[model samples]
Target: MCTPNDTAVLHAIFNPSAPFGDIREDKDSNIQEDPDLDSRFPADLLEAVLKLELNGVTAAESGDVKTAVQKFTEAITLLPERPSAYNNRAQALRLQGDVTGALQDLNHAVELSNGKGIAGCQALVQRGLILRLNGDDEGAREDFQRAAQLGSDFARQQLVVLNPYAALCNRMLRDMVQKLREPDTQDC
Candidate 1:
């Protein structure tokens, strides 16, 4: 039996762009300009890591989550300090039904990025979803708030849903609209 929260979460997960849940696909949008990021790694190593991450994403998209995890692991091994691989791995792990592993990797990704980059935003959003599913509304709200501060529209939407007052108001407005659409049937 799905609760109201569960239904809301399902809707958010399925139709996030218009309103809230999935990690944003626009990688560049959440990236914070950090000059040291480029200076810290050799160009060749960065290129290699990018390739591995792309391959991992492809494998995950193809439903080969195990291969995706392997590829992400290889990328992390190559560049342990980079947060992207960890974020990618967390998604694959979640697909593989390894929520604990996914959460751990997400935490690592957020920490590595100092919660200020694409990896951080993605990690936070993903983790927030997981927390919401686990019925940890406060934890989910905190993560979503952090991501919202980083300019995540989905996170902002999640925050609205998480707010009791906002949810009540939204439901009331929806009820009013529904009533307005109904034909009057009372005898004059």
Candidate 2:
């Protein structure tokens, strides 16, 4: 029952070539510039992080939440500033019923990205889901709106669901159109 949007999200998450594009571009203007911050990572650290992240994804997909969390934690320890590990760990935490931990990780992920990158968008969507589950529809709507602005189709879909007026109007319009289309029900 995976929708097209679900497929697209999976593709985006698994596609290595998809450019996340300079997450630091939105950094605070007052911060001292460090030219080395933009430099490429040491090859060994990069490889380790990639491996750890992949392992985390695999464990999560296999329903091993604890293992996934451990792997993601390792990756985060290795690169504390990397948002993807925090975002991925949040998923595992949520699956394990650690909603508070998930929210904290998601918050960190969003902050690390300055709410301007793929990781931030993903974290926002995840947080929206959590908020909806916690019966905070308004908060969920706000998160979805922000995530939608950042190009998350999943968030856009959630926005449609959260908008009761839109749903009601759509349903009413469909019923009316259907009635008009019915030859016997339509008044000539």
Candidate 3:
């Protein structure tokens, strides 16, 4: 079951720079766009793969997870060595309730991208969420840490969530601020 907190976290992971959800098309966007990946493929092949990816994304947005998976799989078939298709397929599989398949695809995406690009960051965040949901904070933290090093603010947030010390400190700070804001009414 998806809780409000989970939804907020999902939003954070997907749109870290747009906390209020007004996504801007600025250069410093939340999700990293990999120009190297685009340059690696020939123009025609890249165009075809991009079209399939766009279709996959559209299907996913429409809640047609199976069709999204199919489109992503077709893209993967066209470029087996690329990681973006695997990342997209992982998301569709996760939505389809195939957690195992999603994890496998996420792993493949991270591996194919050498954990250094957009696919790697997104895959790491997705995988970390799964691991966190499964009660594996350590594993999730590892993934989030790597993704944070790769410049993901959302991953940095996850790392804070996974750290008990940080949570305690945050709570303590909040309480301190609250007390300062509203001191005891008793006469001194």
lDDT (Cα atoms) of all candidates against the true structure? 0.82, 0.77, 0.82
Local error of candidate 3 at 96, Å?
Answer: 0.8
Instruction: Find the 10 residues in a row with the least total lDDT in model 2.
Output: 22-31
Tens digits of per-residue lDDT for model 1, 20-127: 343434342443546676578988999999999888877877889999999999999999999989988988898899999999999998999888766678888889
Better of 2 and 3 by lDDT: 3
Listed per model in order, the count of residue pairs whose N, CA or C atoms clash below 3 Å is 0, 0, 0
Q: Model 2, clash count?
A: 0
Q: Residue-wise lDDT of candidate 2 within 111-176, one digit each (tens)?
A: 987776577777888889999999999999998888878766567778998899989999999999
Output the better candidate (1/2) by lDDT.
Answer: 1
Q: What lDDT is reached at residue 174 by model 3?
A: 99
Which regions of candidate 2 deviate over 4 angstroms?
1-40, 180-188
lDDT of 3 by residue, 102-132 (tens): 9999999999998977778888888999999
Q: What TM-score fits each model?
A: 0.82, 0.76, 0.83
RMSD, candidate 1, Å: 7.0
| Candidate 2, pairs of clashing residues | none
